[model samples]
Target: MTQQLLLDILPGALPTLETFVAGVNHAAVDAVRTLTPGHALYLWGGQGSGRSHLLRARAQDPDGHYLDARTPAHWLQSLATDEDRVLTLVAVDDVGELSDAAQAALFALFNRWRAAASTPDAFALLTAGDRAPLTMPLREDLRTRLGWDLVYRIEQLSDDDRAQALHDRALQRGLKLPDDVLHWILTHYDRDMGRLTTLIDTLDQYSLAQHRPVTLPLLKALLTRQHPDPASHHADAGRTSP
Candidate 1:
């Protein structure tokens, strides 16, 4: 199936530029929004630093495409070369995890994209990784291609940013999350935005099921139920990275 179709069927949060808390990554976010065709932007940062969120937001564009480690680079070429294709946005996440075969395919595709850089049909490429392009464990040539245009290190969100994000999320769900409740989660649970958001979604469902408003009590009950042992709770939170 096409990447667009796969994205349509996948059930998950739909990240957008509006939802992303720029924190210290405003430049990175702006670059995504004003991306020029044929240019590639490489973003690197710790887990939950909004790399994937930015990619997904750009992918939401009608002319945008999102790919990950699971997608073979050959498939990328086919999509890029589709007869009726126009200027497209290609967002590749977790470049460091691509397999050897995929790496070779990406290398070839990169050259093609670069060769067409000055053309009207040039494709915009964006990629994210755990580390900078040069530091990634990939072929030297591929690494160069990954960083050919621009590179940015995504800054991890500050504590205040996390709190605000949590607040915004609660409001989106029509829940008035108390300041105390927000404080409790940020203080006790993992701070990773991805995991924290998932937790909030779970709480939303649990609140609906139990016919109770979102409160500290409801959150506590769900967390305790989800992780019976206190030790296991902390362990699980620590294990949840971006």
Candidate 2:
């Protein structure tokens, strides 16, 4: 099998709430599901904890707008004053990364949303970050504003939970992933759900190409071929200037 068939980039389709392995995050999931106009939710968690996934899902709702820290101030200001806008969701992801001007715009937009909260059953704002509102090192006023709203910490999936999620994903694609194989991958490979899920599709393609079952050896072979010796770079770097 040609190892040239690596696919660690394209992680397939966007994640949905259904695809999310809730684990101990039922409260967080429930918050997003029950989110309505006049309400704001702040979710915080480490990377790979499915924070961005949920935000992206909600942002796909009707009239939903997804923003990140890199979003420009002008765009946010526009949203704030878009008179005809009937927003169902305003999902601001990675709040910690927002620029100063963007933060100010967000503050204004938040106040606008709050000012109209008396009849706020038509729009919702969602923000996410790496730390809880009380701990995030952001503008004090912005942090305080976010703190006033509903906050939830998204829990990272445990190893067993991750395996089950991967198995279910593989099953959705009509591929049977053995428990042992899943466990081994968890231990020996990148645990990012996105990459693991993409690996499923990649393995499916490679299996058909090589006409082999999705066994431990096949996985090992694929992974080995895809990821060569990591220490090679260090060895090459050691040959630096004298």
Candidate 3:
């Protein structure tokens, strides 16, 4: 799908590193600047740490080329030609998930691109769950070289940061959520920012479906129905039993 369509389906606002309210704010902008000069960067962080978000923002640049490692080897091999030179900003998400042969191929591509006489007008950004690529069950050389460039540890968001993020997201979606409802969702629902944003979208849809305003009662009912507690339902059923 085109990037615009993807954005429409997932309309969560893009988080800016410059004024990012959460996570390791320091490392994000630094990573961007380092990559702008055509250096390979390894960003390490767990899920919900904003690593993928930052990578997506960087890939939005016209010269960027986002190559999902899950893609077929033939696709990547096709990108090796000089015609793809304009694909300067390369993002490889889930590098650890690549196959052994694909890993080797990626390493070779890096070596070839790095050794070019000119900079080749390209930069690479790699993301993985492991801090060092060596821990990802790859060859010794590829693992070692993955850490040759800058590596940043993306920190998780603090509680306050997360609360603000929810509010900001609601505002971006043109939903005027009350502070109490935002807090209730943050306190009761999952802590992952990505999931929280999705819940907000779901609630938005639910509100539209029911033709009702977004209120705490409505949110609670929706959440309870979507994520029903079996024990509580059984208890209520027993109480009403003849």
Candidate 4:
């Protein structure tokens, strides 16, 4: 059976848990799936590893709040001590890039959460960084604390995984994306799963407009529109930026 593409998600790529391609991160996904109150999970990985996606998905909970390096310091501090706040689930991303004040706020928040683990306001905190906890450059206390609970490094998708994802997406859309066409796209264009999947979306649209089946020639034509001009036209049809 063909794997399903995530392109058909409601509201379009909203980063829900269901839309996440587990790949080799099944254990991490399951950990987040069953994350309990007062517990914490820290995820570290290089770019394109879907750390941000998971954090955004977890923050969809009614009581959950998502924080990142871009989040304001005051808000971070506020959440740390807001007595009115009840329940659990705080998802923090890009922890390594947090501002000085934000780092302090998060430090306090961690202490409070851990101290209240047995209390009514006990909560769960999920964090992500570009590297493993101890190696992350941050305030010493916070850096050490990140390793106190669960930690997992997210792995990037393999080529087979990417192919399967795109193949699945085509099936879900009820479109015909030939295996050769898939291989061509993988070889010629950007390999990032997001962009590759986006091309699939574009191909579907072009196919609909032209009233034709998906084929190598049609794929080349679509990329031609993307990469106009004689100079780039011949050197690798899909060399245009994704």
Show how many residue pairs clash in every candidate, following the order shown: 0, 2, 0, 3
* Model 4 quality (TM-score): 0.79
Ranking of predictions according to TM-score: 2, 1, 4, 3
Ranking by lDDT: 4, 2, 1, 3
**Over 4 Å off in model 3, which ranges?**
1-21, 81-85, 172-180, 187-190, 205-209, 220-242
What would the TM-scores of all predictions be? 0.79, 0.81, 0.72, 0.79
**Candidate 2 stretches greater than 4 Å from native:** 1-11, 120-122, 178-180, 216-242
Better of 3 and 4 by TM-score: 4
* Cα lDDT of model 2 by residue, 1-242, tens digit: 22222444233566678867788999899999888888899999997788877887788776788877656678887777775767777888888888888888889888878877767434788889999897777789899888768999998899888888888888887887887788777876665565567678888777778898899898877766654644331100010010
lDDT of candidate 1? 0.73
Model 3: worst 10 consecutive residues (lDDT sum)? 233-242
In the range 115-150, model 4's lDDT, one tens digit per residue, is: 888887788888999999999889999999899899
State the lDDT of candidate 1 residue by residue for 44-130, as single tens digits: 998767788788788777677777776766666665455366647778788899988777766766776787889877888888899
Residue runs of model 4 more than 4 Å from their true location after superposition: 1-11, 187-199, 209-242
Give the per-residue Cα lDDT of candidate 4 at 106: 88
Selected candidate, larger TM-score, 1 vs 3: 1
Candidate 1: C-alpha RMSD after superposition: 7.3
Best by lDDT: 4
By TM-score, who's the top model here? 2
Alpha carbon lDDT at 125, candidate 1: 83
